[model samples]
Target: MSKTKESIFDYQLFKRLFEYIKPYKGVFMGLIVLVVLLAIFSSATPYITKDAIDDSITNKDTKNFLFYMVLMLGVLVLQTVFQLLFIYYAAWLGQNLVMDVRVKLFDHLLKFKMKYYDNSSVGVLITRAVTDMERIADIFGQGLFMIVRDLLTMAVVFAVMVYINVKLSLIVFAMLPILLYATRVFQKYMKKAFEEVRTEVSNLNSFVQERLTGMKILQLFTRETVEYEKFKTINERHKKGWLKTVWYNSIFFPIADLASSVTIGLVAWYGGLNVVFDGTNVSQGDLVAFIMFVPMLFRPLRQIADKFNTLQMGMVAATRVFKVLDTTSQIDDHGLIEADGFKGEIKFNNVYFNYVEDEDVLKGISFNVNVGETVAIVGATGAGKSTIINLLNRFYEIKGGTISIDGVDIKEVTLASLRTQIAVVLQDVFLFADTIMSNITLNHPEISEEQVYQAAKDIGIHDFIMSLPNGYHYNVKERGAMLSSGQRQLISFLRAYVTNPSILVLDEATSSVDSYSEQLIQNATDKITKGRTSIVIAHRLATVKKADNIIVMDAGEIVEQGTHNELLSKENGYYKNLYEVQFLQEEAV
Candidate 1:
């Protein structure tokens, strides 16, 4: 994923994150109440101790001392209860918020245009959806809630200390400005370090994912050592990124600790002198209570600084997540026309398209296929054959002309209805790491096992499926790695047929299949295209000789269109030349 420099406080991002928490406001409010109660209980403990020491212990009133002791124990128990409630509810709220975020992000990705995925990394997307979400959860579960809790405790402790002995309280707070300055500097450096660390983590994940996905290619080319060296460099950068954060942690916390220690020492020294020498104002119990109050005040201050890191990192992660969620590069689906009863009459009128800016792949192309007609487009690589199929399906919108089905522009129909009516099988078939049956039905409960078997039987690949270790129950293992390319292609054919689409598309679908699988695919193709409009994009001229129309393309323009025999009859036609060249190549092979 790409990133821009971000500020430490992204107010907009934080505001967006809080929207997820809105659904759980009642629980959040409960947490806030618990935090305030916990603070009150905590602050009361030191004062209770002061009273016990000065009024009960020193005076030697046995019954009253015992009474205060039990009262102190009860306060501690209540404090523990509130602490436990805060932890539990804070975690509950965080988990629910992360779940909402992850679901929303995934839903957004599903709607993004093909161009976005073309330019993005799978691993980086995974990091944002999974790992970054976990960090966001930590903000509420461990970071934000705890920071608030500590701050409340400290503030309550401070007010009580001032009430007990205002002069001593002033002396204890004298080191606060220095510690605050150190914390500010620490935050600035740590934010930069953590941002770098996040970037490195995304990079490392992307590198590992790509390398592993292409490990077979790497091994075939004997590039393992080079790849490993590259991984080490990435790993080193990742380590260095984290180390920078650790360095800041090492510097920041100790400075906070030292300031805390100095404050404690000063409070004890001044309060102790007033108790022993001056004896006019401060009591022994007041000095004791202030000493106890010092840690409560300074410890939270130090922890607030620590917890701020969590808050900052979550904010950064949230910003990245929101950037993706806010992306506008999704396929436009403004068409209100429902694609019910589509007749599958596809026509492209002088279409122009480009995958990249100002570089047209298909130029001034015009063609039409009537309902139930089979049209084959044959062209050399990069001659705009596949681009036509892509445009017809509205995978990429054409720049200059209209693509229509049943005389209604495709862009005028709802995408879901349009895409659902069309089925496409490309040269490379992708399968998930799931059981064959699940892959076939896509776990759609409406598609029964019987329907799948019938589709496979009709396609004549049922026996091939049975030959597998567990037939339909067998796991394909990521990207169908466990299956041969031919087997995967057969599966793809079965999948397309099962959808019972109105218009079928085969873009060199049999190119990867073996001769035996090719025969089966040809048979399946015939059965599926029997009464539906189908477009076949093929390189092998022989396979397309039986097509209803053979359209020849050259340099992004349609050069010839006719039945195979008619095209071949033209003495110097491009189709005739292409067919002869392919026929010779086949003979040579």
Candidate 2:
């Protein structure tokens, strides 16, 4: 099923976004003050020019003219200085606000259950974290300042024009309503266009990210051309979306420019007639001042319209970001029991689970693993073996029944405490782009170099690691791409061992390794599982032959269960067939 898209301009979303900036109110208010002062200084400049032209230059008044000119220059310099100060402060506040929101969003995402990630794409989430936050920052930094400054400039210009010549000012101001109405209409259209553009951009980002991350798979399957064609199609759609936004903006600007021109032309014709015929209150200086103020008046209105478009885009991005932040994880740590430690007696009593409603994955599954026991689960893909492990780890909560550890229901235990007691080594091992030493001692942050070496030695990868140029300090590239598959799995094994977990989960941990590395990992597994409850989900039947008990699962039900020899005696049992097939394969090898 597809997820629903949400609107960004929802009032609740804006209210929530506003809350992020609330903490930096002092900086925000100071920026506003600076913007207002800058606008006033900018608007007053034209009057200074008019004064020098009409009174000083025209009338040949040299005494105070120089003083006035110097004063005007100082005001211009002051405005420039304050403008820089405000821009800096606005950028700082905006960046800090983005950081706060991004951190909160990331924290909330981490708390989400595995199901959320299963349903959402990694690319979309990453776009929200990066591109979306940048959009919001742009709005907060420049878009917001533009709005405030423009409005202030417009107001000051209107007030000055009326004070100079009310009759001519009224004629010029007659077009204000028309300009405002046009802006309102354009803003509405631009907002919708921007929202569409943001959505398409998100889709484009997701497509590119997915393709790049899966480039190896695409190349392996010889689907490079096919994927390229698909990417081209998405890119074309993004272009179309951007073009639509540009089309609207293109129309908006021209119409705005025309309106402003008409307003200025009408003001000039009427004011000129009054100066020529009636010799009214309007002066040549007043006319020049009005013309200068005309652009100032329409310039801000035009800017407001343009900035509105940007603000809309930012709102769209914010909506996407807030969607993730607002999501309430179904599995919460609330009302959980806290414990100092855990004893590894696990029970799954009549447990039922489903990733989606009405589609049961695990049907009334029940099992028990005693303390310090090795239990092997053998099954084909999608037979619910991994689902059981996931449920045990509380990655996905069971819809029905109870999973308990040492007589305490896992749901009643704190998630951190419950997870702290368990360590997992999966087939697809993930190593961060860091040194091998860091990967092993991930759970124990303060682990010493000696402990890291001991853990690596236990996993039987110490000699190979030491042979590397930098030994334990050798950089593991993204996803451990620099290392061989077997080597990466060995590091994961060492990591799991270092945790000293009460329960160790090995889900095809050695499946990717070669025979030699598999044997080494298997030997390390023996030491790691000593005195701990262990669950091994192995595809290679030989890997779990030494398990204390083996549970054979088929279609989400345990069909057979016994020791290796006992299961082999049942000729028609699933385990026997699996064991025979693996044995034949090994013999062939």
Candidate 3:
């Protein structure tokens, strides 16, 4: 499912594109009818001119001349009406089609595992969801619909010319092969150019998105000038990609224009000769009509070449979008366990896992937490503390292991039901840019405003929320930037509490907060963990002192487990040594 290597006229791509149009078949059929009528009406104009000149003007019949003028006006009026209908309806169909595509793409994105996001660039995904969809929309609004209309116009124009005078028609068509060959060359080169242009667009998107999101870090490190130079490199690459497309267009259109001009010139030269020669069978009216029809024929061919680029760009976009849609990176959700109203005993039976292939983060780890037990896991950096929490949530598939809750393997339950029973609060809390109430309740219609208020009250953070300017309606802004870290942590506590999950996880939630906030969070934690199964991950030795059991981990394996005082009593033990260091450091501060 990497980027697609596609051609200019990909029949298979177009066949897939047509599937999206199937839902609007009625409107598509109507658009087809309008195209045929437009071509017919356009072709009628030249024939009317022929009649007005040969039968009305030349024969001195003013009545017939006036009648043909009225007929031409009627033909123009019909063309205008159908043209308007086609333009408006084509846009409508394109909008609906893009809407469906964008929604489908976003839904597919939601099902992907964390591994997919870990490897993907945010900017490239944004371009696929937004810019690429627009390109696909143009396939309908400007490319395919106009291509059909233009081809029909050429067909009708050629048919009328042959009927009027086959010899003159043959004379004009003599230069078509040269023009067709030029167009073919144009399509081949432009397709490659357009692909490069899209690649550069994705590159630029990735560069800008990363730089902007990390602007604070860039400023703090005073790396602005260095980063600017880096952006210039990417910008140059993007510029060159587009310039290649412009260069292609600059060469292509002139060749097409010259071929069109040469065809018109040849038609004029030979058609004029036939009108003047003594033995010529072609009439002046027929010659004039054939001359007019030359542009009608070549102009559409030129337009088709132009619209073909549009079609090609859309096909490239479709290929990228469909690749994502066809991805098999989603976690299997067919597990049948309901995961409701059960004892919350969790066990990790010889689990082995890694975020990256062949690099084990957790190696043959096993642990058991009985129902309603509070077990604190204390570990050094990269000792697989957070990895344990991620595994419990099934954010990743373990390489080899069985994680069970209440004697049932976690993988035997549906993901939704499994996740509904566990709530996680991490040290790096994330809050959407929304009202305080929405951040607390996540806009879950089932969690009412009164329930949110009561949860905050139970956690003893209700007064703090009411102290804000908008109370529950206060906007946290992006990433809760407007609030202090402790305030954000308290909001996370309320969020987890309101969920009422049977199993609770607090992963270093107290690591970064101030002493005052730590006390408040500890109070909240005591209330919530009273009757539930809890697994707390902490780096600070003092925070887990009151746990029912403490597990000391180093190098991805548990070295000791006992009550806090029992572990502290062992001479030269890892937990005892670590606890003494942290306790002395806090005492010194």
Candidate 4:
């Protein structure tokens, strides 16, 4: 499905961005004031030099020369102080703004529904959170100050030049149109080039992360050479994108330099002519001062042009970052109802769902599980089994019909309250890089250490955890890479168990564990599901043999459903065929 192309710098988006930095507005304003003061003092130096030349050097007034020189030196010192102050405050504001953005973006991401992750790339999102924020910081810290300081300096210099000689000022100012036109052209192309560079960099980062995470699989499959070649292609694309940016910048800078030089050369020629023709009215001192201010004008002009590049790049990054922030959490809980307790009864009535429009994954499916019933859903890989569970959890909204818990529509209960009542243990377990104890208590952080220990023991991983070098304090690597699959599963089981939820959903939760660990998980599952509605989606037929009800699904519809014996008695159904295949395989073993 095609996504909408939304501009990132819409007024509302920047208003929200400004809100994040509003607390630091004092420092930001201080930086602006410092920049303006520095620009004023810096721009005044040429006038001092002019007075020194006309009154001291040309007319041979030694006292006035030394006095003006001393004053100019003092002005230089003051400018430097203000410059330093601006840098300090600008850096402080930039760092604080970036931190606030990162924290808010991360916090918002955690609340996002699973469907968001399913649609977005991890690399793209990471770039927005990390790299994009840094770009914005650079814009705020250096880019913003440069823009303000240069514009103010340019304005002060132009006014002083016009006062010194309006005729010469108008001659010099004629180049403004040309400079602006060139800048406009450069800005247009540079914006496009920088956008491509940003996209390429995001792609390269994504490639690196994906390959690094799957390094083991790549090596085992002997696809290292193939992957290396793929990476080379990505790297080359990134290089080309960067080269395009360089090409534009290279052309832009030299042209800008030539334009500035021409402006200065024209001012010098015109001002010198006026000095010669106008004689006493325009002295050598005034011409020299005009020459000094000539470079100042073009310097700020050049800087303003350069700042546009930074601004363009920052705008591109901001666009991407704001795109994420702009996406409304479609599954947000709008219900005001808060429940102190939950009954495990769940019913899906005439429910329909689709990841894409006009393509139903679950078609008008209806099922009801009474409180404390252990129901097993069996299906082929894409038979909408997991989709049903996802819908029950409201991971994706249903197009038609209602899902309820104890006769209350799931939408009527706040998401936190609804989810707090359900615990899900999936086949693909993810454990954070923390102590075993922390992983177990992830869902119930207020649970005591004793409660954690009891939950771990109930899941039969407590002894194994204790046998480790650091017991419950042992650190797991990313996604629990430090532990065996069975150990990770055990931790996940404990995590679900400690939640003390009203409903339990296990999706091949024990498929990775050994027989012994499986037995332990099964025992824990029995305890946890004692008075809760439980939905088990199992690949292994043997795992659900004792389910109170077995649902066999095929092609997005339930083909047959009954207890294990009842389904086994039907010899021609999909469930019976699956059962016979497993039964014969076990016999051969």
Candidate 5:
């Protein structure tokens, strides 16, 4: 599933697309039968009228006319019935199929490594899953089957015309080649135009999403005017791409209509001459039928070109969608063992890793945390402090080394099992738009609401959560915007604690909050880290002072590892320098 350009009408793309139809194959076949019925009924209209005029009206037979009229009316009712059923089932199948694809796509995205999201645009991915998926629906909903029906009707109409009078049929088809050539040219340009349109659409969505998410930064810097102009430029390009398709459409349909009109006139003129002069060749009934047949034959051909817009856009959408579906960025699940645990003893042995190739972020890093021991990793940014936590949880693969839990290689265990035992509370806490209780339990059925309340009380945040507008049932509203930074951090701690994992990793949660909240977090940290194996990437000296061991890092390697007092005892050591600087800052404050 490499990302490759999919050609319009590529048989392979269609084959893959049709694979989705298996679940609804029975209904799909029923729709096809409906299409056949509709096309046959539509094509029989002119033939019925020809019989009514020639056998009933011309011969002055009132009973025959009445009978043919009844037959035509009956066929119309059947056509309507088939059409109603087709519309209902097609829509049903279209929406359900889209739902299945979207669900599978979302599941695929969830399995992808963090690196995939790091380099991919969120808005472009939305276009793929949401917008592009709708266009693909148009193919099954109407474009594909409807076009087939029209083509089938045209074939039947053309056959009847030739059977009625071959000379007049040739006159009608004289104008056919010119319209088909125009359609061929129209399709070529429309495909290119739509591809450009799709590109611009993705660009516009990406630009807007990025800007809206970063609107705070833009407003703080007063760059609204600059960004607004950029938005206009991108929007104008999107508009121009769509206008090109409109331009082609404007040129194409008129030519088709004109071709049909001219063909009708030619058929009428030739048929009229035979009717007025040659008594044997064409009748008045036949002349009327030829006029009716010309439009029927050309209408589908014209609409085929129009309906192609759906197919062309669908082709473009499918290409972009398949590219995302084909991305090889998901973290491979390598083994079969299911992990359940008692103790948390983590080991990272000679780990080498990088986000990009050939540039190591963690250089042969090695560390060990014993069972029930609390270790704090301390360093400045880019010293690979956070990278250690990332590797421990297998957020990213290590280039060289082994990370194991309880002496079992983490890769050998199922990811869901391995991850269930580890909980991480990052520096930037994220809360979903959900109730406080739901956020704490993460809707995990094992943890009851009673457990959530007890856990909140144990960690001493029960009063704080109860003080909110709805107690634990309060909706946080979009990443917890209604709560203060400290409030969000407290909620994250409660979330991690209720999981009751064998291992807990806190990525310096206390550094960004006010002093009161910091004190609360410190108390919660003391309570939760009592017996679990905890790794705290600490920013403040307070949490680090209590650690069983301190690992000091600098530029992707461990500079020192020892107790806080032992590190302070060393003269001119890395930890000594860090401790002295922090002490001076505290004294000055």
Candidate 6:
């Protein structure tokens, strides 16, 4: 069955969401008390009418009429007071609850294994943390306590109607079965409609976020018209989902209003005959009060059906939010061992990995790098060169064999311990729209301003950064778009350098830089790689020739391993061919 046809409210999902409320139990329970009080005072107003008509108006007693008027006004004042308190406290609790849930969600996402991110969309995760969070807040803000107040008011109205006159109450209640059936049908199908709405909302978020993030590519390929058409189709489906709810509302509410009107007609017919013709227990006072009570009772019943939709939509949001919270894809940090000051010795023993099952991106690859060694890996595209660096950092778990750091299996060391010692500078560097200093230090208080300036000077970009408007404080804007490709590479190198990692990874991205930046990049590379266990995934002959060792990868396996002259000594070695091709490309540049 489709998600819409599935069980409307997952009670299990609700119970899990409600667990977040326990931290503020005092405030939550206080709101419930306020709702109950609000219902009591509001329900009392109808019964006030009966006593005023019977004891004062019917008897023509002036003193009794005066007292009932005062009493009626007092009930209204109390109802208004309790209602104000109910609205304020419920909203306060709702905002607090969602705040706590959003924080927990972001924290959970931070520790998730890279494998989880590999398969998940950035837009869907954003929708879960943002849009879905607000909807869950509605569960408390406008949904639960309001439903409680309405139902309690209805219950009191029902009891008062019966107490005033049973036969007349029975006459009114005969119309109830029809109204109740309509409400049941409305809740069931409205939930299904909302389910569709929520699904479409997620799809729209994913599509829009992806398109906007890659807007440059979309424009470059001139696919704007084609993408716009696809968006309209998705958006139209979303429109239909919402209009389906509108269609249900147009049908169900009128049925509810008809039911209420029909009950009032029945009460007037039955109670009038008894009072006028029979002159029995149903008095003029009771007849007058029933008219007031009929609307009071039916109003909440209709509202409860409407509020039931609010509850349905909240549960749908909760289900999606909790699905992410329930995911077990977080990187296992069970190891207790901490990485301390040590030599940088790394090994991959018969390592095998794949992004998908049995696809084998790394096929039993084995290699070793000793302390303070500089190794370069060279390969054509899809040769699993980057996969080795990923496994070393434990970003992904290998399917077979063991990866060790300093002779200890990496699985036995804590993730922070293992990761803090390694720094990687990728081809496509990512920076927040912040100052250069903040991007380099990432706002770490331990790495003060002096340390940052020193690192920048060490890497020879201090002068370039000083030339910008605010120097180190200059805003690079989104993804360092304000700077050139070479500048971004230098900032990444400075970022990786300040950490003083035991192992440095330089994914040589010198393929697209001007001559001036190329010389600066080469100088920065020399400084950062100088006394560290460095691994360079080479795309340039300068980096490959300087390496103490070069490992050639081809189609998920290491094809050859040796120094530059040694690999060149082989007549048909993989590294020799790769180096020659890369050299020709640079010569053309």
In TM-score terms, which candidate is top? 5
Clashing pairs in 6: none
Which number leads on lDDT? 6
lDDT of 6 by residue, 1-589 (tens): 7654477556777788788899999988888888778777776877788888888898999998999899999989888888888888888888899999999999999988899998998888998999989988888888888888899988888888888889888987888888888988898999989989999999999999999999999999999999999999999999999999999999999998998898898888888888889867788889988999888888888998888888898888888888888898877788888997548888989999999997999999999998988999988899999988888888888999999888988989999878888899988899999999999999987899899899889989899889999999999999899999988988899999998888998898887888888888999999989978999999888888889899999999999999999999999777767657767677676
Candidates in descending lDDT order:
6, 5, 3, 1, 2, 4
Candidate 5, lDDT over the whole model: 0.87
- Each prediction's TM-score against the native? 0.97, 0.95, 0.96, 0.91, 0.97, 0.97
For candidate 6, the C-alpha RMSD (Å) to the true structure equals: 1.7
Backbone collision count in every prediction? 0, 1, 0, 0, 0, 0
lDDT of 1 by residue, 1-589 (tens): 2233445566667677888888899999999999899989988888998998889888988888898899999999998988898999998998999999999999999888777988999999999999899999989998888998998898899889888888988887787788878878887788888889999999999999999999999999999999999999999999999999989999988888888888888877887888889976788888888888888888888888888889878877887888899898778999999886678888989898988999988899899999989899988889998878777777777789888999999889999999888989887789999989988888877788999999999879999999999999999999999998878888888888888889999876655568998788788878888888999997565458768998889989999999989998999988888877885576477
Show the lowest summed lDDT stretch of 10 residues, model 1: 1-10
| 1-589: candidate 4 lDDT, tens digit per residue | 1122233123554566678788988887787788779778876888998888888998898988999989999999998888888887777787898898788788888888788898888888889999999887877777767888898888889888888878778877887788778777777777777888899989988888888988999999999999999989989989998898788778877877787788778867876776778665567777888778877888787777677678667777877887787787768688888866777888988888888789888778788888889999987788988888788788888889899989999898998888888889888889998888788787455888898888777766678789887998888978898888877877788888887888899886655668887777777677776767899996665557868888888867778888888988986978889777764475364
Q: Looking at model 3, which ten-residue stretch has the lowest summed lDDT? A: 1-10
lDDT for model 4: 0.80
Please identify model 1 stretches exceeding 4 Å from their true place.
1-7, 587-589
Q: Higher lDDT: candidate 3 or 4?
A: 3
Q: Cα RMSDs of all predictions?
A: 2.0, 2.6, 1.9, 3.2, 1.8, 1.7
- Any runs in candidate 2 off by more than 4 Å, and if so which? 1-12, 276-278
Worst 10 residues of 4 by lDDT: 1-10
Indicate the TM-score of model 1: 0.97
Query: Please, what are the lDDT tens digits per residue for candidate 3 over residues 1-589?
Result: 2234544577777787788889999999999999999888889989999889889887899999999999999999988999999998988888889899899999999989989999999999999999999999988898899999999999999899889888878877887888788888888878887888888889999989999988999999999999999989989988988788788778878877787678777767877776678425777678678767888898899899899889888888888898889888988888987877558999999999999888999888999999998899987889998989989998899999899999999889989888889999988999999999999889888999999999999989899899999899999899998898988999998999999999999975666778888888888888888889999997555558878888888888889999988998999999888877785586476
